[model samples]
Structures are given as structure tokens and as C-alpha cells.
Target: MLDVAINHAVVIDTEKSVEKKINIGIKDGKVVLLTTDTLIATRVIEAKNLIASPGFIDVHGHVDGYAYSGELSACQGITTTVGGNCGLSPVDIADFFARQMRDGFVINQAELIGHSFSLRQAVGIADPYRQASPEEFAAMEQLTRTALQAGACGVSFGLDYSPGASFVEITALANVCAEFNRVMPIHTRLFTQNDLYSLFEVLAVAKRTGVRLLISHFVYQYGTGIMEEALQIIDQAIENGIDVKIDSGMYTDWTTFIGTATFDEQTIADNEMRFSDMVVASGKYLGKRLDRELYLKMRKHYPNESVICFMGNKAEIYTALKKSYAMPSTDIGTYKKGEGHPQIAGSFPKYFKEMVKERGDLSLIEAVTKATLLPAKTFGFAHKGVIKVGSDADITLFDFEHLKDNADFPDRGKPDAKPTGIEYVLVNGTLAVDQGGFTGEKAGRIIRV
Candidate 1:
């Protein structure tokens, strides 16, 4: 008998964009069959009147194996997440993977060895305002090589958080990532919300280095009414034969550590962002908007805490995601159950709701493809993001009609309210979330890319 099976389901064939009714059988953690013939299993799930698609893959996140973050991701029908994004991650990539592999997690994790924070900090570079010395740059390059050899998905840079990072440092690291053919996900620096020069710098890096570049959180960076122009640049780059991909989340607002260089007094003024525009998303100040006094206190005492910046043009979200190369991402960070940005719990469902069902901007097949197959192909996960025989048995079954995001801004309500209509999520043939809830299976594994 098969280990698990789902019967009477309309499987979403992402590659072909066809819905084929079949019974899928899983054994040994792989898709053993997809046929109409009778199949028996140790456990069978009745998927009648449901659509079975490859489980969603979050292409950009910062879950990093934190328990609450992992549970929240699984709850949204995500089976795999790429962590260590935005230049913050554990320094010991191998040990982190080993620990997660041995202990098991609720969702599969692929990681990028972060450059702006983890590696720089490891090499004793303490100030974000200072560029790395030649010796320090060489040391960082070596650490990146070690991490990539140890199975990290790629190298990630958060230039906005580390404004002092030089072009020399970036290109050197990009060359290393290119040498290994690993992805280079960058959160670009910004002098203003409309500054396109930052985007140009990254495009130049791709042109110069021949590395596959992933512009992380496209909407967050450019959704301030500049997405049209930003996308034009990306399109032109592609036209010029540069390999560039993008990922964006549902909401227009962005969240980040309150202490980053992006929040330096002068930097904040340069962006024209107001203190009132910031709302604490986590920690003791949760749900409070930042006034001058509160901002001062938070910056001084709780600088590491995260805050949501309400500074995006909502319409730009649709414009950005309409690009064929753009994929949905959560940008989720570590937070307690009740104390984080809504994206942690709401991103996928919200993406499906706004981009697909509500706006009609994307067809269902197209939406699922961006959330699934696109990232799998980007990261070279051969067995994932497909619903064929012999593919890894990772799938999502949702109630499309009822699927929506319930999580709201911290001030509006619970930012982490669980989403609706994710009925079942499978990882490696094991049910991780069943009937809109966690099943305590913890079937996740560390995926080496």
C-alpha cells in the first residue's frame, strides 16, 4: 500500500496549465503515481472538489528555523522557504542545516549565506558605515565559498541595511556566487523612494558579473509609485540578456529593524518618511506608532526591534507582480505569535486574493506557477514545484473560493491572524497542515541547492 494518497482531485499541472482529474499516490516520500485507477494507501485523503497543486515555495524569507515563523509559513500552504534573506542569517550555515535536519521542522528550508550582516560580523566588521578592507573582503569571500560549498542556496546582500558596502565588495561577492552559479539575492540601497540609480547599480552588477541576480522584495523597494519605471529597467536588462528575477510580497508597507542605517536620522529625513509613518510591529512597543519621543526611545533601547513603515503606493503592488518574472514572497522575520507584521501569516493567501481572485490581474494557473514552479526553477529544485509522477510529494489543497488573508496591520487587529482556506499542505508526502491547521507532523527537511 502507498504511504499516502489523494483521490478525486483536479491536479494543477503548472507546466501545461491543465487541470487533470486523477488519484495521486505517494510512497517513500515521493510521488509514486498519478492515475485514475484504484489505489489503496495506509492513509487516504478525499480531495473531491478540490484543486491539488504543488505546495507553495516562499522564494524570499527570514524564517531561519524559528518555531513560530515556521508554523506560520506552513499554515499558509508553504512547504519550502528560502531563509537568511536581507543580509541577516546564522553564520554557520552547515551547522544550522544539520540541526534542522536532525530535529526536523514544519517546512523545508533552503538558506543563503548572508553577506551584509552575518559574514561581515563574523569577520569582525562592526560598523555598517565602513567599507571592508581588502583583507576583510578576502576573508568574507572565503567564508561565502565555504557556505556555498556547504549547500547554501546562494549569497544574499542587504545593501540598504549596510549602506557603506562598496561596489568593489559587491562585485567580488557576485563573482564568487557566479563562479558557483548560485543565485545572488540583493535588497538594493535607496537614497530616495524614487531613486532609480540604486536599481541601476544592481543591473550593472548583473551586466558586469554574469551572475543570476534576484532583486529581493521588489514592491517594497519600488512600490512607492516608481514600479513602472523600475520594471522597465528590469525588462530592459532582460532584453539585454541579463538574468534578473524579482520577488515581492502582498502588502505595500515594509518592515525592518528600527536600528538599521536606513533609519539613521539623516537617512530617514532623506527618504521623506515621517516618524509617524512607523509603527512598532514587535516587542514591548507592539502596535504603537512612532512619535518623536517613542522613536527616540525605540532607537536607543530597542533598536533591534522591527517596525512597519507605511510608505508604499498600494497600486504599485499589482503593477509589479504583473511582471512575468516576479514571484510572491513573505519577507517574514522571526516574531512571537502575536507580535509581527501581517506578511508572516498573510502573504500567500493575500497574494492569491488580491492578484488573482480580486483584481483578475493573473490567471489561477499563472498565480500558482509564480508561487511554485518559478522559484523551484530559479533555485534548481528539480523534484519540487511539479505534480508529476516521481516528483517530491509536496502539495497544497486550498478552497479557492474562500481563500483570503485575515491578518491585518498591528494597529488594525492581530497582525498574525491565521489565514483562511488552506485546507491541506503536504511536505515530502506527510501532511504538515490539515484542514486549515497544523498537524504536528513536522515533516520538513533541509533542502541543499
Candidate 2:
């Protein structure tokens, strides 16, 4: 008998961009059969009037085995998440993987060795504004090699978080990633909203080192009336034989800690961001805007407090994801239930609602492909992203009409509000979300490259 079977569903064919009514059989956490045969299984789900697709792979997230965020990701049909993004990750990818393997996360996690925050600190570089010394570079390079050999999927850089990370330091690590044929996911630094110069700096590493580059959170960086121009540069880079791809979230606003270099006085002034546009997203000051007094207090005492910066044009979100190489991602962080940005809970559902169902920016097949296969291919997860025979039994079933995002910002309502229409999600043939609620199962594995 099969482990599980779903009969009579509109199964998505991502490779061919088609949909067909088909029955699927699963066993041993793998897709075992894909035919019209009526098969018996230990458990069967009647997928009447439902659409079944390969589970989403969130290309940019910070889940890092944080249970609340992992559960939230599973609830949104994300069966796998690429974590340790934006230059913040566990210092030892091996230990992180070992711990997650012993204590499984809610969804499968693929990790990247982080540079700016995690590695720099590991090598005794305490100041974000001071460039890494030659000794620090040597130490970081050794750590990078160790992590990559231990199965990190890529190397990530949060340049804005470490504003002092020199291009030499960056390219040296990029060479390491290139040597191992791993990706470099970068959170490019910016001195201003129109800082196309920063984009070039990131591209220069990709161009020089011959490493594949995945620009982290594209819309957040360039959606401030310059997304079109930013995309043009990416297109040019791709045309010039640089392997470049990007992930964008559905919302225009983004969340991060108030203490990072991103929120410093000089950085804020350079980016032309206003205190009024910043709202406390988590902790005791939740929902409050930053005036001078609150900003100083938060910067001093509550530096790690999460804040939501409302920037960029909302239209820029749709525009960016409409591109061929663009994939939807959730810059999700570890947060308690109801105590983080809505992106943690709302990103994937919101992507489908806004991009596929409502806006028609992408057909259902195209949307599913972007969320699933494209990311899997980008990160080289062969078994995780497709709903074919021999692939992993990671799947999502949803109703189109009811698919939408219910999560709102802290000021508007609940920030971590769960979304609607996602009915069932499975990871490795185990139910993670059943009847739209999390099953509290620790069935997810730590994906090591």
C-alpha cells in the first residue's frame, strides 16, 4: 500500500506549464506513482475541486530552526525554506544541521554560511563600520571553506548590516563559493535609494569571480521608484553572461532590527527614510512610530527590537516578480506568534493572491513554477520542487477562490495573522498543515545543499 494518495486533483505540470486531473500516490516520502489508476494507500485525501502543486521553496528567509517561523512557513505551503539569509546565520553550518536533524524543524531548511554578521563576529571583528583586517579575512575564508565543505548551500552577505565589509573581502569569499560551485546570495549595500552604484558593486563580484549571484529581497532594495532601472541592470548583467537571479517579497514594506547599521542616523539620512515611516513591529513598543525620543531610546537600549520600515511603491512588488528570473520569497525572521512582520505568515499566500489570482501577472502554472521549480533549480534541490514520480512527497493543495492573505501590519491589526485558502501542506509525506491548521509534526529535514 502507498503511504498516502490523493485522487482527482488538478495536478500542476510545472515543466510543461500545464494542468491535468490526475491521481497521485506517495510512499516512503517520495512520489511513487502518477497515473489515473485507483490506488490504495494507508491514508487517502480526497482532493475534490482542489489544485495540487509542488510545495513552495522560499528562497530568502531567516527561519533558522525557529519553531514559530517554521510552523508559519509550513502553514503557507512552504515545505522548504532557504535560511541564514542576509548575512546572519549560525556560525557552524554543521552544528546547525546536526541540531535540526536531531530536533526536526517544521519545514525542511537549507542553510547558507553567512559573512557580514555571523562570520565577521566569529573572527573577532566587533565593529560594523571597520573594514576587516587581513587576519580577519584569513580567518573568515577558512571558516567559509569549512562550512561549505560541511554542506552549506551558499554564502550570504548582508552588506548593509556590515557596511564596512570591503569589496576585497567580499570577492575573496565569492571566489570560495565559486570554487565550490555554490551560490552567493547578497543583501547589497546602499547609500541611497537611487544607489545604482551599489548594484554594480555586487555585480562586480559576480562578474569578477564567476559565481552565481542571487540578490536577496530585490524589491526591498530597489522598489523606491527605481525598480525598473534596477531590473534593467540585472537584465543587462544576465545578458552579459552573468548568472544572476533575484527573489522578491509581495509587500513593499520590510522589517529588520532597529539596531543594525541600516537604521543608524547617517544611513537613515542617506536613504532619505523618515522616523514617521518606521513603526515598531515587535516587543514592548509594538505599533508605535519612531519620533526622536523613541528612536534614540530604541537605538540605545532596544537595539535589537524589530521595526517595520514602510518604503517603496506597492506597485513595484508586482512589477519585480513579473519578471522571468524573479521568484517570490519571504524575508521571514524568527518571531513568536503574533509578534513579527506579516511577511512571516502572509508572503506566499499574498504572492498568489496578488500575482496570480487577482492581478493576472502570472498564470497559475507560471506562478506555481516560479514558487517551486525555479527556486529548486536555483538552489539545486533536485527532489524537492517537482510533483513527479521519484520526487519528494512535498506538496500543497489549495482552493483558488479562497486563496488570499489576511495578515496585516502591526499598526493595522495583527502582524502575524495567518492567511486563508491553503488547505493542506505535506513535508516528506507527513502532514504539516491539515485542514488549514498546523499538525505540530517535526517531519521536516535539514537539507544540506
Candidate 3:
């Protein structure tokens, strides 16, 4: 008997961009059968009128080992998450995975060894504005290689947070990623709102190092009036034979720690961002808007607290993700129960609702492909993004007609509110979300690329 059988569902074949009514059988954490015939299983789900597809893979997130974040991700049909984004990750990649394996997690996690913050700090470079010494750069390179050898999926850089990270330091670590055939994801340095030069810098690195480059959170960086120009540049880079891809979320507003250089007074003034546009997403001042006094308090005492900045062109969000090389991402961070951005629970569902169902910007097949196979191919998770015989039995079943994201900003509504119409989610052949509620299944594995 099969371990689980999902019968009579409209299954999306991401590879072929087609949908068919099929019955799927799973056993030993792999898809064993796909057919019209009925099958017996230890547990069977009748899933008529629902759309079944390979589980969503989040290409950019900060949900490294946080259980609540994992729960929120699974609730939104994300079965595999690529964490250690934005240059922040555990120093010991192996230990992070080992701990997750020891004490099981809610979804599969593949990590990226971080450069700007984690690796730099690990090498004893304390100041973000100071260049790393030659010895420190060598040490970071060695640690990056060790992490990659120990199963890190890529190397990530948050250049804005580490303004002093020299291009030489970046290319050195990027070369190691290329040597190992791993991806290099960069959060570019946004010196100002109009910094197209930042994007070019990253493109230049990809051009020089010959490494596979993934730009983390494109919309957040260029969703201003410059999105058209940014997309044009990306298109040009791809045409020039540079392997470039980007990830974005549905919302125009973005969130990060208030203490980061991105939120510094000087950076804020340079970008012409209003203090009124920033809202506290976490910590004691959960929903309060940041004025001069409150902003200074948070920056000084609560530097690690997350703040949501509402900017960017809403139309540009759709425009960016409409690109063939663009994938949807959450940028989900570790947060307490009521303290975080709505993207944690809303991103994937919102991606479908806004891009496919409501706007008609993307067909259902195209939307599913971006959220599934595109990221899988980008990250090289060969077995996790397709629904076929012998593939990993990680799946999401949703009613597209009723799909909607209920989570809103902190001041607007419950930031972590669960979405609607996601019927069931499975991770490694184990039921994780049943009838829209999390089933407390720790079936997820640490995916070492």
C-alpha cells in the first residue's frame, strides 16, 4: 500500500505547463504513481475541485531555524525554503542543519552561507564600514568553501549592510562559489533610491566571475519609478550570456531590521524616504509609525527590531514578477507570534491571487512555474519542484477560486493571519497542512544542495 494517495485532483505539470485530472500515489517520501486508476493507501485524500501542484520553493527568506516562521511558510504552501538570505545566517551552516535534523523542522530548508554579515563577523571584522584585512578575506573564503562542502546551497551577500565589503572580497568568495558550481545571491548596495549603479555592480561581478547569480528581492530594491529601467538592465544582462535571475514579493513595501545601515538616518535622507512611511513590524512598538523620537529610540536601543517601510510602486511589483526570470519570494524573517510583516503568511497565496487570479497577468501554469520549477532549477533542487513519478512527494492543494491572502500590514490587520483556500500541503509525503490548518508534522528535511 502506498503511504498516501491523493485522488481526483487537477494536477499541474510544471515542466510541461499543463494540467490534468490525475490520482497521485506516494510512498517513502517519493511520488510512486500518477494515474487515473484508484489506489489504496495508508491515508487517502479526496481532492476533487482542487488544484494540486508541486510545493512552492521560496528562493529568498530568513526563516533559517525558526519554528514559527516555518509554520507560517507551510501554511502558505511553501514546503522548501532557501534561507540565510540578505547576508545574515548562522556561522556554522553544518551545525544549523544538524540541529534541525536532530530536532525536526516543519519544512525543508536549504541554506546559503552569508558573506556581508555572518562570514565577515565570523572572521573578526566587527565594523560594517571597515574593509576586511587580507587575512580576514582569506579566512572568509575558507569558511565559505567549508560551508559549501558541507551542503550550503549558495553564498549570499548583503552589501548594503556591509558598505565596506570591497568588490575584491566579494569576487574572491564568488569565485569559490563558481568553483563549486554553487549559486551566488546578492542583496545589492542601495546607496540611494535611484542607485541603478548597485544593480550594475552585481551584474559586473557575474560578468567577471562567470558565476550563476541570483539577485535577491528585486522589487524591494527597484520598485520605485526605476523598475522599467532595472528590468531592462536585467534583460540585457541575460542576453549578454550572464546567468541572472531575480526574486520578488507581491507587496511593494519591504521590511528589515531598523538597526541596519538601510535604516540609518543618513541612508534614509539620501533615499528621500519619509519617517512616516516606516512602521514598526516587531518588538515593543509593534504597529507604531516611526517619527524622529521613536526612530532614534529604535535605532539606538532596539537595533535588531524589524521595521516595515512602505515605499515602491505597486504596479512595479506585478511588472517585475511578470518577467520570465523572476520568481516570487517572501523574504520571511524569524518573528514572534504577533510581530512581523504580513509577507510571512501572505506571499505565496498573494502571488496567486494578485498575479494569476485577479490581474490576469499570468496564467495559472505560469504562476505555478515561477513559484515552483523556476526556483528549483535556479537552486538545483532537481527532485523537489516537479510532480511526477520518482519525484519528491512535496505537494500543495488549493482551491484557486477561493484563494486569497488575509494577512495585512501591522497597523492594518493581523500581520500573521492565515490565508484562505489552501486545502492541504505535504512535505516529504507527510501531511503538514490539512484543511487549511497546520497538522504539526515535522516531516521536512534539511535539504543540503
Q: Estimate, for each residue in 1-449, the C-alpha lDDT of model 1 and write its tens digit.
A: 89998998888999898888899999988998989986789988898877798999999999998988999999998999999998888888999999998888989999999999888899998899899999999999999999999999999999998888999999999999999999999999998888999999998998999999999999989999888899999999999999999999988899999988888898888999998888999999999999999988998999899999998889988899889999999999999879989999999999888888999999989999999999999998889999998899999998888998899999888988999989999999999988788887888889888
Q: Score each candidate by Cα lDDT.
A: 0.92, 0.91, 0.93
User: Residue 346 CA error for candidate 3 (Å)?
Assistant: 0.3
How many clashes in each structure? 0, 0, 0
| Residue 29 of model 3, lDDT score | 95
Tens digit per residue, CA lDDT, model 2, 1-449: 99999888899989878999989999998999998977679999888888998999999999998999998899899999998899999989999999999987789999999999999999998999999999989999999999999899999999999989999999999999999998899999988988889899999999999999999999999999999899999999999999999998988898899999999999888888899999998888998988989999999999888999998899999989999999999999977667888898899999988888888999999999999999999889889778999999999999878998888888888878888989989899998999899999988988877
Q: Tell me the deviation in Å of residue 423 in model 3.
A: 0.8
Candidate 2 segments whose C-alpha is farther than 4 A from its true place = none
Task: State candidate 2's TM-score.
Answer: 0.99
